[model samples]
Target: MGESDLIHLDVVGLNPAIVKHEKQEKAEFSINRKCYSHLKKKTFATFVASKRISSLWHCCDEAFSDSLSIHRHVSNVHANEVDMLISAALDQMSNQSEADDSVQTSLNECQAKDASSWMPDISHLSEDKFSEGPGEVILYYRYCQIKEPRLIRDWQNELCSRLHLTGKVRVATEGINGTVGGTKTATSLYIKAMMAHPIFQVMQVEDFKTSDGGADCFPDLKVGVYKEIVPMGVDPDVISYKLAGTHLEPDEFHKEVQSLLNDGSSDSDTILLDCRNFYESKIGQFKNCLAPDIRKFSYFPDYVEKNLDLFRNKKVLMYCTGGIRCERGSAYLRSKNVCKEVYQLKGGIHKYLEKFPDGFYRGKLFVFDERYSISFNDDIISDCRYCGTPWDQYQLCSTDFCYQLVLSCTACRQKGLTACCPLCQVKGQTSSRSPTSGRVHKEECECTNSRPRIPTDTS
Candidate 1:
């Protein structure tokens, strides 16, 4: 067997017998006997003409771009030896055909084992190609009901992995929310494939918020089923998607914000209430919007209930990173009849920014990805959390276990100021010196650690 064959077996857990049979079948199907004979006649001349390693490397590189470069290098540099190896492969195939009974039994046993246990590390196959191209980033969400979230998640995960794309996909009974990054071609193809699915047929390519293609948008793909895509900690019985607020298109939202600013209408009656977490709105928000001082989406329900009087007889505008949170949040507000009208940016801040750069919305939009913020202009609306200087760069807490991000200036960062708060700073410092104290406590303001438990009858 070739080293490539051995690698296939090791990496993807392909049964050796099955791999060998498949290879033999493909070779037989693709190579015509007459053409093979003609190739044999021309092989020696071609090999002799391409005597230099550089010439051989170029030929292999051009012809076998999908396979291992090293394998191509060896095959081309040692053409005579490759011919011998081909003869041996044919002989081995003949011998393997006679042991079909034994191989069949082994194949059945291998098939019984879990396929997901041995995920192939495809980085070796496509890392070089990925590094060569600018990446396309897509952010989208849907709020339709899903009967089989897990199945959808698995299918999306496999497809994205094979396509060498990276992003996060959340599947919930209510819908799907995802953001992916890949080569422009790959992302375009992915959108087509997703739209073809019966469940997502209503989805339009125009609905997706795209970034100018770049190489460093995301690191890897992660897709899974979740109780709630946005985790707003509300019972499904309490709110329905049908009752959500009206979706204002980018241009419509822009006009409304402009009107409010132009009129100096910053009072409760004509309010733009930001539905996203405080951290997100701290960095960027629509001008004159009331961003609640909350840490998580779950708290928004209560924040709204407590501030019910503010929404009464008011036109409340809501938004988040994407529109998932607003779907339920606005619905809840409408159910209470707390506002005269509730309007949400159709595709959230992402879509709005695309249409109106440096418009009503100002500063960098914070995203929950490696590329922390996407900027539409040079506006700096925030300052370093520690130094209070005009800086908006985000840094994850230096405490090994603390994952909270803080805006820190260069001087503060250089002085080891990486914690989100004083307690976290001390915890980070203490934990570093004593590894046993590495367990990180949840931030005081955080309501719950994991996704809020799906509301139950008992509790």
Candidate 2:
């Protein structure tokens, strides 16, 4: 056969079998042959050549050897004309195959399949529904080795910014810890993104503890790479989470706490230790738990050092706000070689409250945000620091320089007892009087000095 006849046979006969075989014989040979004939007549190469010689202004005289290069060229240079060019090319291909009935039928089937594939599957979008509210806040942390924390930090910053989230995110080689607030949709998206991340695939939707609040709960967005996701004032290299305490689920921890409560013997060997700071435990804590009086988390190491006798040969149960602190805090306690055993609440009070809101936990759960506390039950355990009335709400001391929080009730606050302590009140009054006071620096105060050297009995 002549070259033209050979080309026609190759396009019409041989190509069909190849295409049919590749499709696992799904398409009949007759249909495949018709498809190939249409494709060969309106080949992409012919389309590229036609475009090069057309009256349309081209960016450069360079010829592309492949479709990818041509696509790149068109996208980079004639971006504004991309839709027009695509429509023109589709019209040209359709016109070439309009005469053949079999070709038109095959094209219709293929176009239907292609269109279905392009149509987005909205099945997974239904999972995005959250509680009906203006917004929400998500608290989550993971302890895994991250070789490139800076990359993770950058990704977090970009993701949170795009979602219009406001909160603090800390990334380290160990992992990431954050509590972000945004619209329910945004928070839901953030959770999905975290679950999809390669480094954080181990995380589940349950790992994220959500509460009612929004972007307004925080002042602004802050994301950065840090030495430790949760600052414990100890190197993670030395006190690793791998050496941390055994994890107890909410139910398991509840049972354990119940057992502790039931045992009235003085020889009870287990101890419930609150790993959170004083300001946190001040409002709420597990019944009879030994809560440290340290102001900041960085002071925890020293507290453990000085109070080593308390945990000596005892089974210690440690817990914190969202379980991140207890991970490192338990590790630090374990490093001291004093405790016989250490166990932590798996998801902390956050998860426990979800499962058992009205269970053993009482009062409000202190959170680090504009919403100072969140409550599950209306149990008033703590009293106002000023009037001694039952109150659990916390507010920042009115003194600009003092960072202490005041547990003063609304009644006391109305009576101008907003300061954290007498020293803070005196300082605030003095600072407000002098225009040239220039902010006096006070290091030690009654509030700091009055903190118990050891745990006090709250029962």
Candidate 3:
């Protein structure tokens, strides 16, 4: 985003502690600085020949233009090590599928249709091919606009087989921004089929860049119509956060925080707030971020509406994961008749950690999907329960029967490898070696760790 569209990082309560870390790391680029053009040049596109990403984009500073390069480094130099692991994972999935009849498709003729129009159920999808590795899927989008709706729904029903995906996509007038999962082949076919559509022939796309402008795109496939492609305009209680608006990078937001810190006559009057769920805020929050009786986005508004008198005339700063929530959240505060400057981090702590690792954010930031949690910038923010080492990377149980993600530290792993859980570990390890053994499927995979859980009754 351009500089004007930024929210102040300072409002997120990131300063001094964070600023110090960035300067030392030499990663201290101003998050608020509008280097859109400079960063854009590094903007690359690739139609990944086939979804065999050895290296997901690594945030290795600016040394590499993209993560693909990092993947290349790991794969080319350490191909043998990666291959062994991949083989092991795939074998595990194949064996697990044998045990679970549900994982395999048992189609009935009644559900079949020819030259058809039927929306497929999301529940029926599975990424079977991921037994080899984290399957790669590519989605074809038309420019920033999606004018076709009926076609998408039909595609969902007739096209997408029983493929698995992380389900969080919506279609809207603006465009699409949902995430799902599928096997490498399924995702690839879906993208190819999308381009074959005559209606979208003239459309521009950003997703294709992943393949370097080639036909070899996604490895798996599934395209469908969601409530909202991006799900931006939804109910007041949909996603977490009270606000939703354009975001500011960390740099610009930090400047504002400095002002707030200096504006106060004394520190006591400074009202701090942690505008996130108790679970999220607990991991790490600003020194003064408030922890109120709120869990979901819906209850957050009520908390401010009923208890705003405490900071009716004080400088109150708030923040959330992404800056989107503050858009709606801040508006609710305005209606309370409490006159105070409402501020939030543009992209929440995520942007802050990009530059300042050991900043105010103390632990791992929880995510909604299978990725579970990612480490904050520098320190081992959160501890691994088993070994007590700082670890935030989430792994689902490796057992195909139990694909639920569980937080595990380095020492917690069963065989010095990340699996879905101990159940998956027992299943994968004990199974007799198979032809497809160790090909894919870590068994430790899920959509997200924390979804938008609304407040029912927070006691």
Candidate 4:
């Protein structure tokens, strides 16, 4: 290709000024180098051809001549970007009345180029780096538009498998929420990889809340595409993070909690709310915060709907385990328009304890893993269910069919107070013990009544 043809291909749809500058520079250089201009043109054509081939296989640096191999490579590796581009093109076409096949072809070419521009080279991440020290568990979530969740899920599965990490990852059209545990080096590399990804580039190092643990913290890796990353049991399109409450940094949240504590009056207009479930708060929670008695996160909407009077005209300060719940929870609460104002902890309790280990939050932070909970301070805010002894350790109910977690001190546990309640203990004794019987057919206990099912709000 000649200089003008190469320039046109390189600067297609780019700024007119940039194209003009490129032409001017070419003209200036060509005047004195006319003798070798033909050779330069041949070299440029070869370079451009190789560059185009490399662009087509952006994920891996391999260039394939076979169309089938190229298709396989792109689908297996760059499926997420491909889906995103197709979705964008469709969206653009839908908005334009005169859009045709030519318009779509042009749009796809432009979007593909743009997508490949931001893809980072992960070829060097072939080997896992092992560290000597203990591993860490990272808890993080990002709310952004993901055009194809399944492709993201595939990518996450492959990445986590390669790093030998274990944990749960929930992907949705709205975003991704994950808590992976691995070696210090592996976790560090995972964070770097996530930040390098175009979809998650908005994330910072601090966004991944790390705690002392490793792959063993979780039983296995479970990554899946879901309706909502956090499963608020509401349509993500209806209650999105965009409509979430204002975020307050750890310092600001600390001050707000301190202010609430300082105010001894019962009629304060501001309310400190724990957005976590009852069990989570039972172990540890902010001092004097109103923790709802909901069993599952899905019930949060009903809890709010029923208790609207409590939040009416009140400035609500909300917090959760790692901030994922509060994102959609706060949005749901705000949708009611009952509260005067709604604000959530920027990074939730995790970020709060990082800054102030002995801050307003007290006791152990509950986590959904084998570890059960991680402590920041020496505070034991909870008590044994059987005896009112100060304890925060959680153990599963001894009843085989019951999945409920109960707190029983050493003394009580030794005395066979292992069930969630006395009734469950009696039932466990009378019922036929079968090895095959599991929590899937869980018998209703007294605690079951507390979690009354509410119709899902599809609105």
Candidate 5:
């Protein structure tokens, strides 16, 4: 590319005033060891200052391909100018009340050459110093009204791109739900940018459940307009947040669980219902909770209908992964007036684990990502489908066209864990089954049909 083409101002948004500032006499700008830490706080002043510094480096990148080369060029030729520009940016930022005092002090102490040198080698700061290591992950959702979902989706895409984040975000008239991952810095910038948006003005920054991981959690960024953040398959107008169940704090939930256990009433007045899909509950759940055996969330309403008698005169406590599902699920139940009272885990199991890790919930938390599952405790609740050993590690069936996932122990897998279920195994052995039609016939595994054979433990 030509120099002019490569140095296009679109990426820089560079103003003539910035060039004028660069021409001024050099002032020392120290690279503070703690500068990256302060950048993560999400204060407006810090965000703006970081954006400016990022822009300055972005412009510098346009002039040179290799960061080391740019560091050398700036150190030898434009060290003073770059320092002056940074000083000007820092000076402007220092006037803002939200800017960290340490940030300004660090910039002032940095020697231009040394500072330029360090900026190019930022990848080295990947240790414990940062709250989020290089590739951290997060799951956040907001149940709020959106006037323009398409516009919000477009804006979200640009924001995620700018921050080098990848994940899926679904926006609708009802709200938004997403689980995304990136380097700690990228995800931090994304949260800052998202909070600044007017559409998400009411969103509580603390509501986001940030976990340690990397961008590999999601394959790519996918933002789109959806009907609901958590699909309950109901009209949005029928239910609202005001009608949702009471939210119990983590400690409160723990206390309540203790009370329930103490009551020792076989005919309990309260119910702890797991609102997640059957597969999710198969791996992990709270002790003594009533986890429905439904295949998908869509069956939840029907489940409630069939079990209306169970909810009568009872205080029901419902929960899901991140709380969004329970938000609507509880609302739907409350609207029916079948239960005496309804409540849900404030932030769901994710938040509950934050306060009380390995307390009540057990086994691995099955996540819809490349990581598949995360452990809360060493307790393995489920047994290997093949060997019947105490194992919770789940994997897709070895059958190419079958999408069923089952718990297969290492020993079982080694012993030729082939089909998802016994029915599939029998079908796989027959030449009549086509590879494309390897999916087990749902009817064959249903209650009406013969139950799928559970492999007897051979070991």
Candidate 6:
């Protein structure tokens, strides 16, 4: 490989650019961090810039060798002066805007955000027989740290290649983070491979766990090279992350959860708090877990602070996706002198899923991959708010203006019920003629308050 083969454009200061990539095996991005976070916001931006000729150049000779192809591909990219990068930037802005909007809307209203994360359409995937699923492990992990950007990228590729996993990999100067999924043995073997093998030993992996239902939990694997591992994008000053905490096994932790729920016990002042985003909890959680209404992981610190007074004298049991949030959250809470004893679910919900496939937990498991959601049993968690029956499936509204995705079973779906529910019809419709006109408030439309509260965290 020549000097030109080290092809990475300095995106540190670029306003934002279209970044088109991904073939059959990759996930293409039109705009990267530099452009998307700073510039436009829309659902999908159309391709504005044309591809420059230089991008089409092939550096490899006719020799069909793998090594040569890799090296030559690098060279071609480095020397690429094509305007494709600019075009990619514009397209990304549109996609980002849509994603951002969808996420924010989903947060407050309890609805599905962008459909991008859905692997195939949810309706389609639900019908297929996932025989290789069930007990198969289905999750991934990404740890971030400061390193040479190019080195990190190489390490990511090596990590996936060595594990023989299929997904994406990205490397940036700030740090690296990604998600990859496979089967039970494959996932475990990959972890062991990363830890013991010296071939790609630079990568440090944190343990990830989920239950038997993980198969349908996440959609698919997604890897993106970001300037920061977890996308805080914060300067080193305001907050510096330190992943330090004591590790607890399943036996020791489950006892604590049990003690908290049982009354008249010596472990009286204990709090079971969940530290995950709202959607994950909607799927599955501990029976008595205290699900916090948080929209994003980054906001955990604030929730901890606000709720500190609630559990000041009590033992605080905190948890999240992996043990990532709790490791940091416990330390933060401890520092504040709020809780008497701070404990986090050792490996979060994933570990629980692995240990107790059909254990105490009840309901589906929500993940951040292509599989929208997975149920521990065959049944769904929450029902259509109006119907008051079991229903875990989600569907986007046909009405363009009411572009919301929420829980709806086949029965409710068949009714052509889009916005208002049966209950809403009762309270909303004083008279059939002008029913939806008066007395039916927006709050009446959303029955989340009345529906049995689902766990509100990923873990």
Clashing pairs in 4: none
Model 2: weakest 10-residue lDDT segment is: 20-29
- Candidate 3 lDDT by residue in tens digits, 153-246: 4445455544443334444433443334555555555555444443333333333312111111223333455543433244434432323322
Residues 1-459, candidate 2, lDDT per residue (tens digit)?
222232235553354332321111222222344454444433443445456432122337775533356757765776445434433533443454443422323432433332122222235554323333479899999987676676677778777876678999999988899999988887887888787664565578999999999989999999999999999878889888767787788888998999999996677899999988887887778887888878789889999999899889999989999999999998889899999888999899989988998887777899989999998888877788888898888887888777778889998899888998878898789877867346654534568877665445455
TM-score for all predictions?
0.67, 0.70, 0.41, 0.71, 0.67, 0.53
Candidate 1, after superposition: displacement of residue 287 in Å?
1.5
How many pairs of residues in model 1 come into backbone collision?
1
Candidate 4: residue 315 lDDT (0-100): 93
Q: Is candidate 1 or candidate 3 better by TM-score?
A: 1
The model with the greatest lDDT is: 2
* lDDT-based ranking: 2, 4, 1, 5, 6, 3
Query: In model 5, where is the ten-residue run with the lowest total lDDT?
Result: 450-459
- Report residue 188 deviation for candidate 6 (angstroms): 7.2
Model 1, span 392-432: residue lDDT tens? 78877776665677888999889988777666688768877
Cα lDDT of model 4 by residue, 1-459, tens digit:
333343224332433222111223212222112212222333333333343432132325676643345556655765455444433433343334233322212212222333334333445754545434579999999987676677778778877876778999999988899999988878887898788764675588999999999999999999999999997799988888878887777988888888988996899999999878777888888887888877789989989999999999999999998998999999999899999988889888999999999888888999999899998999987789889988889988888768889899999989988998888898778764545444465644677665323211111
What local distance difference test score does each model get?
0.67, 0.74, 0.44, 0.73, 0.65, 0.48
The C-alpha stretches of model 6 lying farther than 4 A from their native spots are 1-146, 154-177, 182-193, 196-221, 231-244, 264-268, 377-381, 395-405, 418-459
Work out candidate 1's RMSD over C-alphas: 19.9
Give stretches of model 3 more than 4 Å off: 1-165, 171-177, 180-247, 258-272, 380-459
Compared with the true structure, the alpha-carbon lDDT of candidate 5 equals 0.65
Worst 10 residues of 1 by lDDT: 450-459
Model 3: residue 46 alpha-carbon error in angstroms: 28
Q: Cα deviation of 38 in candidate 3 (Å)?
A: 28
Positional deviation of residue 438's Cα in model 3 after best superposition, in angstroms: 37
Model 6: residue 177 alpha-carbon error in angstroms:
4.5
Clashing pairs in 5: 29-107, 29-110, 30-107, 30-109, 30-110, 135-213, 135-214
